[model samples]
Target: MTDPANPLVSTEWLEKNLATPDVRVVDATYYLPVEDGDARAEYEQEHIPEAVFFDIDAIKDDSNSLPHMLPSPEVFSSKVRKLGLGDGTRIVVYDRKGLMSAPRVWWMFRVFGHRDVYVLDGGLPKWKAEQRPLDDHPVLPEERHFTARFDTTRVRDLNKILGNIESKAEQLVDARSAGRFEGRDQEPWPGRQSGRIPGSYNVPYTNLIDSQSGCLKAPDALRRQFEDAGVDLQAPIVTSCGSGITAAALAMALDILGHRDVALYDGSWAEWGLSDKLPIEKGPEASASVSTER
Candidate 1:
């Protein structure tokens, strides 16, 4: 059920339509520590004209110890308003390495009840490679009212995740790579466990995205991808990934597939993996037994 009006846009489409008054381009780039790239610094160096940098790290819930957890509705509204995003604006978000981090911002807007948002396919890399346009000029945006409608049902806290695990009320989906999900590879974060949450399915975020195009796959294609990975579309699903980044990608995929009940585990592996008391299952058995509970 991909929205006919709001499907992911390509670099060519953005280049042509960027000048539209209602369109607001945002550089939603975020880099991993392993990459050693500064997202804000890169955004400042060069970006799409009038595209402001949306700091994913800064708009997080500061009260939580976990990394980049979703902020409260009030906080989110204030931060987005400062960026010139409002109810009437049609947002187009992009990241440095294509589909890496922009989907998180796309999902954030949806969480706040904005449906006019989309991710820029192929991101800055493709845009620069195609020689579309780039501007180093700083943008000062006028303030506007961005109504924040916090959908509590779209988010799952630690307690809700624990309860879901115990009650088997929802299917848990992990977007980490197969190795990380199975504990065969170590976590990127120090002292964090490698395995996924109990009874979680593994559908790496990479699978849902086109490597070359950097856009999400078509709806039928996405459906098959999830089914092939053993995900039950009809069941309630909660998505998780390392530090809650890629988990948002999973949530975005579900959104395009018309799965409205999907919830994101904000703490994700950052919180769950670091706790010694939490159960950790190793090997492919963890992935194999996914969705066994009805």
Candidate 2:
């Protein structure tokens, strides 16, 4: 169980308190193209009783070429309102694969000025394995008013990130695998150049998760992981992943570790990798043995 003061909540805690009027459970499941799975279809088949499926891909900056970019405040407000989210609601988001998609949704809510949100530790698999509860029927929710206030400061654009790369004003943390970071592996998206941004540290998102349990490791474990990876948690970090999804998991862990100034690169490698002009580096920096490319 999570401390009442913290943002995270366990499946057991959610099961016991889901009936609270102020609480809302959301299934924020999204699969990578490589997974060959349908998140929506799986949600429709079964989910936590009243949980609504929050489609991360469908709601985004439609005008942008980037995949699943953050949507405008008005757009987000209208969409989530239709999904029954309200200003006073305390949201608990979960994904089929634990720490994958849920933290992205949690960060989305936070960027929209909604702080009373959290990700479910261990997600649906853990809940099901424990024989807690499940429902296949569609959920019907009462309509509620949702107001969105986009906090631009919380998000960093491509130009801003590029400037940071040269200035070293903030730490760049890439969540992609070491192979992807070092330009040795091709990205899932074709035509994108392999390599990480110059000066960015390589800390694969998988390192932050417990492989067996599909949950975030404890804070001490997370600290050690970052430290061993040559990351300075005391410095401001801007996290990036294949797109912008898994980076949120890194951001969440940083938040849990009490690092306040963490931010996410909304375009991430999806944009950087596609461009030929962006600087790329291969091999690790002196600070860390992991290879990195830009």
Compare the candidates by lDDT and give the number of the best one: 2
- C-alpha lDDT score of every prediction, in listed order: 0.84, 0.86
Tell me the tens digit of each residue's lDDT in model 1 across 183-276. 8887887778678787788999998877766667888988997898888999999998988888888887787788878989878888887777
Enumerate clash totals for all models, in the order shown: 0, 7
Evaluated at residue 140, the lDDT of candidate 1 is: 97
TM-score of each: 0.92, 0.93
Q: Cα RMSD (Å) per model?
A: 3.5, 3.1
Residue-level lDDT for 112 in candidate 2: 96
**What's the alpha carbon RMSD for model 1?**
3.5
| lDDT agreement of model 2 with the native | 0.86
Local error of candidate 1 at 128, Å? 2.2
- Cα displacement (Å) at residue 86, model 2: 1.2
